[model samples]
Target: MNSNSQAIKLFLVVAFSCTSLLASLTPVLAKPTPNRFDAKTILAQAKTFNQPPIPSGSPPKIRLRGGGKRAFNQPPIPAGSPPGGRVRGGAKRGEPACPTPKIDLTALVPFTQEANSVINVWGQTTVEHPSWFFYVPYTKDSPYTVEFVLQDPDANEVYKKAIALSDKPGVIRVSLPSTTPGLAVDKQYRWFFTINCDKQKNSPPSFVEGVIKRVNLSQPTLKEIETAEPLKRYAIYAQNGIWYEALTTLAELREKNPQDPTLKAEWRNLLSSIRLDDVAEEPILPGTP
Candidate 1:
């Protein structure tokens, strides 16, 4: 062979080898496998966001005597008085709100790990009206009336609804109706959920209450939420401190896919992060009234 021919052959051989090497790695590079979802990692990232501060003192205990109908429009428990006050239970202020002897009621409010029954949810400023979630633990399999009441910062009654729950003990989600008036931006509202156990006496109602505020979301945030994948959207909400939406989205997803172990784990992790491990294992039932 001539020198030039040999040189050309050598160059071709080198080029062919390089091409084969790249071809072998093409699948591994081009079709990269996605990382498995890590509940702890995602939760850690979420904790980096600015969450509302948990109240310092214990919640107040308000024991209901007789069938007296205290006005629902009363001003919220004074800020320095107590964080969350129980209606009847002798538990000190800042204690869990739904400490029913038989059942426990919990609001799906963020930053509640240290809070009593009263939780404060940091919402998006642009969101007019938002939904809320509750974890109700019932010892018996009987029908119970769940009452939801919303009061404005001025303690004015804004919305009220009574839902009849027939499902067995589990976590229930409550979405404010779009038809209802939207929450004003930069405003705080107090919400109360009571499980009317004794209808005839109406003395003590198993109840949980929390405060929610509406804040504005930046355009980039809105875009991210709109474009993010369904599974990842909740994490985004959590990282941004959008409590109501995060809990609601994960819950709705879990309800639709009851058998998804990943969703179940995510749900448990989400609740556990808030110190609600007790009710974390409860089933996510379909349809909330």
Candidate 2:
């Protein structure tokens, strides 16, 4: 090889090595930015955007005016029912009102009970005056035996009697008589009657209250029968086509001589003839003397 060529080659190698070394040692230049962001300002902005710190594990506290307790003692609530139910008012418990008594005439009369003589108006002692007669309608279906009870203002029973009712329909006349010969009248003597009927079919133990009425017997009157008279004698009897002076005359004859069929016929006839109006009519006035 020539000396000039060897020198040229050595120069080229050295130059290439120098150029590679310069390239390796050279610094890299960055591109210029339009706007700059400050670290301090960025840190402040991040702190503002961050979520608030979580609360501690505890319930919030609240203050009340009054203590924590109910105002009233509530009643026990029924299960599956509405609360505080049903406020109402009415009649007190265990109290029953008085019921009005009604009379049933279709039932049967009692034959066993006897009449009381203490309340007899025609007999010695009476409850009412002779002029006035308290009447009970005799029902053909049932014979009712009424017991008369005399009561004072205190509701105490002083006198009572069970009078057998007549079979036929007629007034069971009660004639009131004066207890004293002469005196002013006082409070009305109150007498009530109770009807005792035999145990009837399909009916409860039946009875009636306040059957008889009241009268002031002490009141003065013109008609005074000071003498005792039988109720049958005073009872006006209507028989046949004519009204008779007495009821028991036929009954008396039948009783005295039971062997006679005529007497029985006479009694039946008299009973059939007894008309209500015939007994009600006042006696005819005597002609002017």
> Which tens-of-lDDT digit does each residue in 1-289 have in candidate 2?
9999999999999999998887776643344554445787777766543322223221112111122210111111122311111011111233212122221221110011112211111111123332112223444355434555554434565455565665443334332335422211332233444443433422222332221222232323213223313222222121111111233233344445756765544434332222112223221111100
Q: Give the whole-model CA lDDT for all candidates, comma-separated.
A: 0.62, 0.31
Which candidate leads in TM-score? 1
Model 1 per-residue lDDT at 189 = 77
Q: Give the TM-score of candidate 2.
A: 0.25
Judge candidate 2 against the unseen true structure and give its global Cα lDDT, from 0 to 1. Answer: 0.31
TM-score each candidate: 0.62, 0.25
lDDT of 1 by residue, 140-184 (tens): 454456688988878999889876674476677676788888898
Estimate candidate 2's RMSD in Å. Answer: 44.2
Candidate 2 regions off by >4 Å? 1-134, 139-144, 175-185, 198-289
Cα error, residue 16 of model 1, in Å, equals: 86
